[model samples]
Target: MSSPQASPAASVRADVWLWAARFFKTRSLAKQAIDGGKVQLNDASCKPAKAVSVGDRLRIGRGEERLEVEVLGLSEQRGPAPQAQALYRESEASLAAREAAKAQRKLVGAMAPPMRPDKHARRELRRLKDSM
Candidate 1:
């Protein structure tokens, strides 16, 4: 018997693609952003159901950073970080901005002590609390 015909190329929803690509930590987070109109497709805002295919451009916002990327592949299953990265090509500007943010965070982290109060600070806090 002849093999069944292969199904035509099918695209996944933008939110699903983003989640599968590991762009967002959770599918709901992606959906929330999509519903809130924070994500853009080809420079135009699109809903969560907007289909995504290879070569499509996407602008995603997470926290204080924005990622500008071009889809390079398609997958609906979430995978490792390295594999997820293969699904999209980030722009140079995005990479640079991420690196800069990383560097800034590192510098700030180095300049400050751990957030936990030190013993001396704890004693001072006790004295102040007693006074109050």
Candidate 2:
């Protein structure tokens, strides 16, 4: 009988982990962003070569979107979306913040009507009637 294969420990390079977990497209891109000081580990900025282990928290920034996640596991190879999702656990605050931002955006979106000028603003009715 063959013995079951043992799984490897959950650990990966910070950049590779980020890329494999879908935080960035390519490992080099992830490294560049991390080296440029765009990524944080447990709230403090970290280097690209830093090792990431399970339970480590990361704060990643992509444009206006900021995501906070805790490393639940690690994978060196880039995999499918479902497998990638197994790597990290997103923070509750991050989810709430995103939802709040969405709601605020909807409220602001409702402020402006489709047309630039309303009927009331189209003409000064009193002036028009007086001229007539």
Candidate 3:
């Protein structure tokens, strides 16, 4: 009988791929994202255990950053960054869009509100909330 370690195949679980690719820090985080519909296979959201193979497409949304990648290979074990990166290829358009979004964020950084409101500002915010 084949052991569990001998079960590697041409395809791999969606969550494991994400973790190995360094997209998520842990398998749990990747699984959580899958459950929350933040990860999609071939343009449709899929379960964490869904088998992902080479040539398959994926859409992943992290915070405000969205990514589209094409699977190039599969690995049953997690590896170093360079090796993990070999498993997928990001589309040029997706890379460009991410870059543009990053640029926009940098340009608008100075316009964002302070981290925390001052005591007077907080009082004003409370007054505004009370009126509603």
Q: TM-score: which candidate is best? A: 3
Model 3 gets an lDDT of 0.88
Q: Write the per-residue lDDT of candidate 3 for residues 1-132, one digit (tens) a residue.
A: 542223358788999989988899999999999999999999887999999988999999999999999998777667778877887899999999999999999889978877888899999999999999
lDDT of 1 at 25: 87
Task: Write one digit per residue (lDDT tens) for candidate 1, span 8-118.
Answer: 356778998899889788999999999887799999989988998788999988877888999887777787788788888999999899899989988998999779988
Model 3 segments beyond 4 Å from truth? 1-8, 113-132
Whole-model Cα lDDT of every candidate shown, in order? 0.84, 0.81, 0.88
Distance (Å) between predicted and true CA of 101, model 2? Answer: 1.6
How are the candidates ranked when ordered by TM-score, highest leading? Answer: 3, 1, 2
Counted clashes in each candidate structure: 0, 0, 0
> Which of the two, 1 or 3, has more lDDT?
3
TM-score-wise, the better of 1 and 2 is 1
Model 2 residue runs over 4 Å out of place are: 1-10, 109-132
TM-score of each: 0.74, 0.73, 0.78
**Model 1 alpha-carbon miss at residue 27, Å:** 1.7
Q: How far out, in Å, is residue 128 in model 3?
A: 29
lDDT of 2 by residue, 1-132 (tens): 311111174467799889888889998899999988889998888998788888899999887677899988777777788878887888999989878988888898899677665678566765687899
